[model samples]
Target: MSEQESQFLLILFGGIFFAFLMSLFVVAMVILHRQRQVKNRQKLEQIKSEYEKTLLNVENEIHQETLAQIGRELHDNIGQLLSLTKLSLNSAKPEKQQQAKEYVNQVIKEVRALSKTLNLDWVESLSLDEFINQQLHRIQATGFCETSLQSDHSFAELKKEEKLVLIRVIQECLNNAIKHADPSRIDIRIHQNGKVRILQIADDGRGFDTSQKSSGSGMYNLGKRMETIGGKFQLSSIVGKGTVVNLELPFSV
Candidate 1:
């Protein structure tokens, strides 16, 4: 072969080699971009989880603070005023007006009785099963309606904090029942599967349509709290039959 012909062939081979190198670099850049996208998604998920935990903690602190303020008002102010009112009524003795004073005293007495029962902290340490039963006993004790509690077996070893949350959820449902439906009976049941604890609270009260459920703050809070712990919350209600609240928590050792 001629010397010039050999030089041309060498330049052609070099160009082809350079093109392959550029193609390899482009492929590498594409791969790195994809990996980075995946990493960003994972980080976003972590951030979301952290934000939810922060929200939950903030809500818990607020609830505690509010309850403490309520306790202070009941014990420090209302209690003392009621006592003073009762003392004056007793000091004044008139047979004709005595009955009216007695009625006033009675109202104060009833209000005082209610002050001692407002904040319930015992639920903070109760187990899931125990908490459910406690709520039933409470509602039943009122004598306004009967409450029945049943459990399939032990709960899924739920954390004490979560137990309290679920207990609060049950209590809220009961309160709504009393306030709205005036149910004759309320039934609460618990069940556990391999990795989920199920709580069902049903009341034979005049149920309202749950179609606009997202508007109720109490129910929305219940759902949010349960979801923060990898749990599920459901509500079903019929205008005449009853309302049913279902909560499911994933079992974590």
Candidate 2:
């Protein structure tokens, strides 16, 4: 072969080798990018699984707490009323028979109302607005604070799981306000705009600074619980002005 031809062939071979190397590099980069994406997606799924597990545990705890509260009310409040009614009946004279009859009727009514609360499955049956209003009634019954609920729209279409999570979340919010905030008044408002449903719980209590670090798991759990349901939780508080919690959830989801 001629020397010039030999040099030209060498350059051509070198160019082909460089092109192959460039192609290999591009393929490797694409593979690596896809792997990273898969890893990220797996991580998110794992996190979601863990969050859901935690939520289940939290929900169970709340259920137990609620049962305990009911037991107390049954024993301390309803039980006493029944005892009084029984005595009133036993002591009835002809002159007081009408009064005793009225007292017995009242007791029957109270028992019937309390019986309705004993059924936990009512959570599945009642509308979200009714459930919340019941909670507000319980708070008022306790005389811990004055409570009110206002809904611009009714939420009758929440899924079973959505209702469960929301029920727990609202219970936690009210419990925190009553236990920690020492609020005199608590108000819950529910409304909808377009495709979004908004729930706000506001308290007139001693609030804390959100920027400051606090060792409270309630707030952390609240945020995590919202995330699990693909919702957003926001809190705003001023030292003495009180605190308000804002939750936004998609109506369809």
Best-performing candidate as measured by lDDT: 2
The TM-score measured for candidate 1 stands at 0.62
Candidate 2 yields a Cα-based lDDT of 0.83
Q: Which parts of model 1 have CA positions greater than 4 angstroms off?
A: 1-124, 212-214
TM-score of model number 2: 0.75
lDDT of 1 at 61: 52
Local accuracy of candidate 1 as per-residue lDDT tens digits, 1-253: 9999999999999999999999999999999999999999999999798756745664475366447646765686567666666666666567535665665666577666555445444444446667567657867876989988888855647665566566556666777888988999998888777777788889888888777645558777778777766778999999899999888887776
Candidate closest to the true structure, highest TM-score: 2
Write down the lDDT of every candidate, Cα atoms only.
Answer: 0.73, 0.83
| Per-residue lDDT over 107-219 for candidate 2, one digit per residue giving the tens place of the 0 to 100 score | 68867766776646767778889988988998898889999998986467887667777888888888889888999999999998788889999999999889998886878
